[model samples]
Target: MFDIIIRSATQRKVRSGLTVSGIALGIFALVVMGAMSENFNQTFENSMSLTSDKIRVFAESGMFGGGLTDDKVPDVKRVPGVKDAYGILLTTFDEDQMGMSGKQIFALPPEKSRIALDPVKLKAGRFLEPGDTYQILVGTSIAGEYDLQIGSKLEIHDKNFTVIGILEYTGSFFDSTAAIPLETAQDIYNLEHSLSTIFAVPEEGIDSDILAKRIELNVKGTSTLSPRELQEQASQSLLIFSVITISSALLAAIIGGLSVMNTMLMSVTERTREFGILRAMGAETKDILLITLGEAALLGIIGGLLGIGIGSAAVYLINLWLAGKGIILFAITQRLLVVALLFATVIGTISGLYPAYRATKMSPMEALRYG
Candidate 1:
């Protein structure tokens, strides 16, 4: 039966190839979209994982909005349950500063920034030390995008700073930032003694929620969010992107299924005489149906495998391009591969049912006469 199915498909190579291509396209969409969504979710989760027992305190107006002064840091630390608070000055790099726009600048006191910077692994050189006012640490993305290296000098507002360190990829926005001393950042931005945000660590035995509430009450004009809250907000913002990708994959699959069904129907019509002859030679209706389904299944398997190969290659090229910019947008996983193959197979099998049924229903004599 399998041999018959193979010979039949081979007999019409063009039709079979087109059908396989359609199914492959669908599987390609599924795998690519799934990989992208998974990568995004994992990056966000990994970033949030680093925020153990800490709450972020920022201006109610948002991170880019008018920021709080450094005085807020002491006020937050004075709140009950708060163990320590550190201020970060956030600003953006202009074309004059880094030959590009919107690259982030994070200003931190060398000693106090370790809590936030601990997650960042140094790729080359050393992190900023106390009294290293004119030194800067660049993120992996920034380093790659700007072709910067250790000892490289960056000019910010007519002042030059040496790149003392390069950080490993953290899979977060920090990957695109330049870290400098807080005072230097304040001077550059001309915001005397002001901060972009504050990070507060709760004392041992104090719940983050309780600490966040205390800080919010004690620190005016600022919003406090536990790490989990921040994670949830980020997830919500990315949900739409996930939905669109998945929806497009599904649409492609549906279209592919329809193409499979159409091709299977044509195959059934063309092979009517063969099915009739088999039935006349004592083959059962179930045998004819099985042959039809087997053909569709074979097409699906071939197409799915091809799709996996193509999708993986596409993902590799995409990652290669993004690497130069310090971004990764795809993570092909075992689950995605398994699901893609199974989805393609199921669609093929289901699509073959109508044509298979029609093959089974043909009267042997009528099919022979019609052929």
Candidate 2:
């Protein structure tokens, strides 16, 4: 039976090939899209990590609605279950020419500023320390754009800050940013006690959410944004990317399926007499159906395999292009590859089903008489 199926499938290789290609295309789209999504998620998480492991609170009453007046930080800290809170003003530098102002997060810790960005990847100099009036920790890309190195003097808001460090490349939005002391940033922005944000660490063993809620309710000037809140905002932009990939994959699958169906339908019509003769020669109706079905399945499986190969190659090329542009932050893992292949095979088999079913329903004797 298997031999017969193989021979029959091989005889209709054109139709089978089309079916397989359809499945493969679908799988290819999925794999590429999924890999991109994973990479983006990693990049986003890394960028947020720079803010440290604390919840951010912003003013709700004035400019941008999230800015906190300087006097509000102490009031927010006085809330029950609050350990300590610091004033932060997230903004873009006024002197930036690359339009990096809104793209950066400027965290201000008045005393011992605990904000550190992926310290493990600190490439040159050290993370920002307390009482360092004019020192800044710059990301690699930002550092290169300005030709900065340790001891390089750069001015922010008229005050010259010595470049203390260049953070190693981590694919995040912060890659093009510089961290300044809270006092310096406040002065540059020309705002008094008008902070755009604050960070709070919960007291030992207390629920972070409950504490966050309390902060929201009691802190009149600010609203609390947990890590999850930030992630959701980040993911909204990413959803657009994921949707595009999925749409492309679906379109490929549909086109491929139609081509396979057309090929199979033509083959079935051409083989009418052959099918009629087999039916007359004591072949079971079930056998006739199985043969047609097997042909479809065969096409689907082969096409799926090919699609996976092609899609993987495409992703590699994409990676190479991105690398050339100085973006080597994300990698496609092995698990993603396996899932893509399996999906391709399933799509191929499914696409072949309608054609196989139609072929099986044809009256063998009538088909013979007509063609």
For lDDT, the strongest prediction is 1
| lDDT (Cα atoms) of all candidates against the true structure | 0.84, 0.68
All candidates' TM-scores?
A: 0.88, 0.75
Which 10-residue window in model 1 sums to the lowest lDDT? Answer: 93-102
Task: Give stretches of model 1 more than 4 Å off.
Answer: 93-103, 156-159, 282-286
TM-score between model 2 and native: 0.75
Q: Which ten residues in a row have the lowest lDDT in candidate 2?
A: 110-119
What is the per-residue lDDT of model 2 for residues 77-148, given as tens digits with 9 covering 90 to 100? 898998877776767654554543323646576253433343436787877777776788776656765678
Q: What does candidate 1 score on TM? A: 0.88
lDDT of 1: 0.84
**Best candidate (score: TM-score):** 1
